[model samples]
Target: MADRDWSIETLHDDYRQALRIDAVHYDSNTDLQRIRVLENARFGRFMTLDGVVQTTEGDEFIYHEMMTHVPLLAHGHATRVLIIGGGDGGIAREVLRHPSVTHVTMVEIDAGVVEFCKEHLPSLSAGAFDDPRLNLVIADGAAFMRESDAEFDVIIVDSTDPIGPGEVLFTDTFYGHAQRRLRPGGILVTQNGVPFMQGDELTNTMRAFKALFGDATCYLSTIPTYAGGPMAMGWGTDGDARHVSLETLQTRYAASGLACRYYTPEVHKAAFALPGYVARLMP
Candidate 1:
């Protein structure tokens, strides 16, 4: 991928690759507006409900791996993992990358997204749905946290932004629930949103995260389809902050771990080094 800088502006590298062929309006489904799937010459085909490009066919691994592997490796031994709001099965694919990870329980609100992925996105999901290591549950992520007695080594909140169906997932209540759902040593991570475009919301979300988790950190990456060129991730822990060492990730995440275009070790470590504006939000 050669960095490509991964921006939202460039012509060939930008998100304006291909066009949608057909769109349907279904009310029995979701209130998320402008929901439609697209077929692209470059990106192959993808399902995008409510105008939010759920997962692009071309670069699903970039987002999914960064979201899943960073925390899993950061925690050092993430044998048991939980995913909230990632119905596409991409995060689950990355979670299973760790041989130590015995199982993953995916709590998703939209069962339709799963069906869509199973039907169209097998390449991106890489059969994570059929893996014995996964337990797919159709339920609200926040509600699942409230009732879950399971203790996970890591919890990755692969949620969309705070609005429409994905609103409650960003609340402090959900963060508190996530804390309870984790073991004492468990680490929590989430996609925080675009820093450049949704700046205030990003800061506020970090604040909500800080209130519940003992330690919290925010980071950024470039995801073209999102609001701005830069997207973000939040790292929180039930216990104190722990640094991910070189030795810890030597086995699982290497210089060129798996097939990834965007997330590199340098990018992985540098993502957490926030700017002055974003850093002020932390404790």
Candidate 2:
């Protein structure tokens, strides 16, 4: 491929952060939306969905580890997992790291994202799709949760920012369905965008979650590629929210025996230590 300049901007009404790519590995518009696989000097291989940078080679572990390990470890023992919209497979890979996760039913709206990422951005999936535990379902996540009777011990909403197709997943209607699908003591986690830049996103999610679960909160993790202070992951469950202790996390981390670059037992506790500014955004 010839060298070409590719400029992509984050998806926000007012945010101006953008990335200039050195090379384009793949670019196409699927039935769902536009997708781009680009190589950058700083972030290396990364993919953007509908112009928003989803994940990159440099800092994906931060997002994936925090997203997966937090709720899984907090839940203590999750044999069945449901992942919504993480076509990149990073979330699934991390979920399967836990020996207790016997099955993971991943529902991605766009099959194109999965195929393209598998072919060009192979590192993101990291062979998680091939794992026998992964039951990859291509369908609208909200519809799947509403129609299916299957229950999950942990339902992870690894969705993109609430836009386009993702808009539905953030609504209260979908969240209610997700809550109903969870087994007793199960937890629901979501990708609530950067609180600094997308405060409304966090606030709205917390409102809906709090209404359904009564125990809703947000956690923080810094992903450089997201170009914000810290990204927020929405947490909700009917279970005890105060159960996440340092000792518990440490015990779970040691038992898993999986080495991770970003998720540490200590960091797990710290992620929920939201700053006052971010806390103000919560309901």
Candidate 3:
């Protein structure tokens, strides 16, 4: 067996998680960020951007499923979808599974991340890049939201943490623009960081969401790679999707026939139940 080197994730200053790298699949500086695809024993192939773990082949289904399914299924009839910053195509892969979805406009800042992930971590995308319904746009996500006249039924912001290229996506201006691009009852979901470690991140997003939308809250999902308890998925909409009955969710889930690993009708409802500590952070 070849010798392994450990890749330490420097996401948290006080605590860090290290993954054993069996081999380096791809490592280079992309136009926007430093991207690395590493092979690991337990997590399989994983991708990191700027020394932070983005996704892995092993547990990608958990994050992708929750991020895409919760909002789409709750909305019950989301045909047009807008995805910002999901370069790995994992969110698109899950969104396309619903046959009701007609068009998917995926605006990614770095085309290199899409191309590299498609080659190195193909399973995460699982042929999503080749889908005809997907209209891939290479542009800044915040800029697209500001300038485009197009609207969507659901907008999923599959972004990185509030730093680097993704910093713009977390701003109040970006959230306001995203709300404007949504069709009347449209839902917006964002990748908020783990509340345990990044409490301020969730708080700032909630504050923005509350000011912009009628229903602003977050749901939780635990991904092993992400570390520090459960990660929060920000939810915002002026519509009643957040109040959709469990029976309604079950009907929608059954009709879609989605085979999800982490997201189910029951889990979807339970995810919205925030712990006291996390709820205190919300505006």
Model 3 ranges with Cα > 4 A deviation: 1-4
List candidate 2 stretches off by more than 4 Å.
1-6
Candidate 3 residues 1-283, lDDT tens each? 2223888898889998999898899999976789999988999999999989999999999999999999999999999999998999999999999999999999999999999988898898899989999999999999999999999999999999989999999999999999999999999999999999999999999999999999999999999999999999999999999889999999999999888888999999999999999999998
Give the lDDT of residue 48 in candidate 2: 84
Candidate 2 per-residue C-alpha lDDT over 1-283 given as tens digits, one digit per residue, 9 for 90 to 100: 3223655574666766656688889989987798999888888988988778888988998999999999999999889999999999999999998999999999999989999989998988889999999999999999998999999999999998888899999899999999999999999999998899899999999999889986889889999988768999999898984367889888888999979998898888888889999999988
Backbone clashes per model, in order?
2, 0, 0
Query: TM-score ranking from best to worst?
Result: 3, 2, 1
Cα TM-score per model: 0.84, 0.96, 0.98
Predicted model with the maximum TM-score: 3
Better of 1 and 3 by lDDT: 3
Better of 1 and 3 by TM-score: 3
Ten residues in a row with the worst lDDT in model 2?
A: 1-10
Model 1, which residues run further than 4 Å from truth? 1-34, 239-242, 251-259, 280-283
